[model samples]
Target: MNIATRTLLVATAALTGLAGTALPAASSTTGAPTTASNSCPVKAWGYRGHYMCGTKLKAGYIDWNRDGRTDEVFVIAPNRHIWHTWKNAGGWKEMPGRGRADDMVGDNGTGSRSRCIIVYVIKKGYRYYQNCHYNGRWHNWTTSG
Candidate 1:
């Protein structure tokens, strides 16, 4: 067969193989367990160690402790509040202030992946806020434009 035909067949076969798969539903907005468990089944890399199963937005990961390793994750929950957890930790915890976010960004600042900084836009007011971990502690969250 021609290259185009062969590619089509391969794609079809791959899709067929995935037909029986079903992605887990997003976690409920209320009464959802805060700890990770087998029922918290998000098949994504960010879900590797935490309890955030049905996050509403893409997950963000950072070193968070300046240890040159990415171990923290931030995700927007189904209720719009931002929640986070660490690798091999206890469970997911809501961010301070319980602010809702429309989008989030995380980076290591000017240093390596060790330095963690996160900025998120509020879902209601569209204002920006940020927090960072430095000097052996996490700075308070502050608002900005």
Candidate 2:
């Protein structure tokens, strides 16, 4: 074969080999769910901070470990008091104290008072440490019962 013809054939063969070896660009799409799961509960207190003063400490919801369901309820007092209650327990139970400063204050403005309760639903074996005030007064979030 002539030089020009031979060169053309070689180029064509190279192009064909490249096309056979190459693949089309892959898609960059994902298949993740848009909404959150039902098991994972939402947190009333976004962070580990005190809520607004005199907000009438209410029971807040949280998933804690994010399992998609609210299994735990937390009672948070402005005086840094924390109580962990579960759905199965049927009642509230005080957690061990960490000896931290009070988040709420007393009428005298010197001592602290229990004024809040936050509820959190977390998975089993999930341990959380918090500092809170435990004055003898039982502050209920739902009602004055």
Candidate 3:
């Protein structure tokens, strides 16, 4: 084949390969693949450090790693289950307990450089459960019942 024809064929093949590339799918709170037809009740939300696309009822962020940057993202997925992911991993994982909660709140720990995360889960009408990530570990769900 002539030089011009050969060069044109090579360029066409490269363009075709580029056009066929697939993108990674966004994940739901359960780590399941999410598309446009999922049954998530609420719309996706943008957390401070990361974006969560699922049936996210509520979401909050904290510096769970104590790295001075807000990197941890927590969300209330379907069935009132709490799921969390960080900026580094970008994958959602269920919280330690299997308990379902109605609402969730997060806050940073006290003191300079404390870098701890305190999460509160509200259930029932007047009951609240607490959990925390401190000193590089997560504490299980706790309630004063």
Each candidate structure's TM-score, on Cα atoms with residue i matched to residue i, is 0.48, 0.27, 0.49
Q: For candidate 3, lDDT tens digit of each residue in 1-145?
A: 7899957754553333212222135454436224433234322233221222332334365654566765666664433445666655545665664534444545545344444333333323334555666666666666533
Among all candidates shown, the one with the greatest lDDT: 1
Give, for candidate 2, the lowest lDDT window spanning 10 residues: 30-39
Clashing residue pairs in all predictions, respectively, total 2, 24, 0
Q: Sort the candidates on TM-score, descending order.
A: 3, 1, 2
Report the alpha-carbon TM-score of model 1 versus the true structure.
Answer: 0.48
Q: lDDT scores for all predictions?
A: 0.48, 0.32, 0.46
lDDT order of candidates, best first? 1, 3, 2
User: Where in model 1 is the C-alpha error above 4 Å?
Assistant: 1-59, 64-69, 108-116, 122-126, 135-137
Residue 77 shift from truth in candidate 3, angstroms: 0.7
For model 3, the stretches where C-alpha displacement exceeds 4 angstroms are 1-59, 64-69, 108-124
lDDT of model 2 at residue 36? Answer: 17
Q: Pick the candidate with the highest TM-score.
A: 3
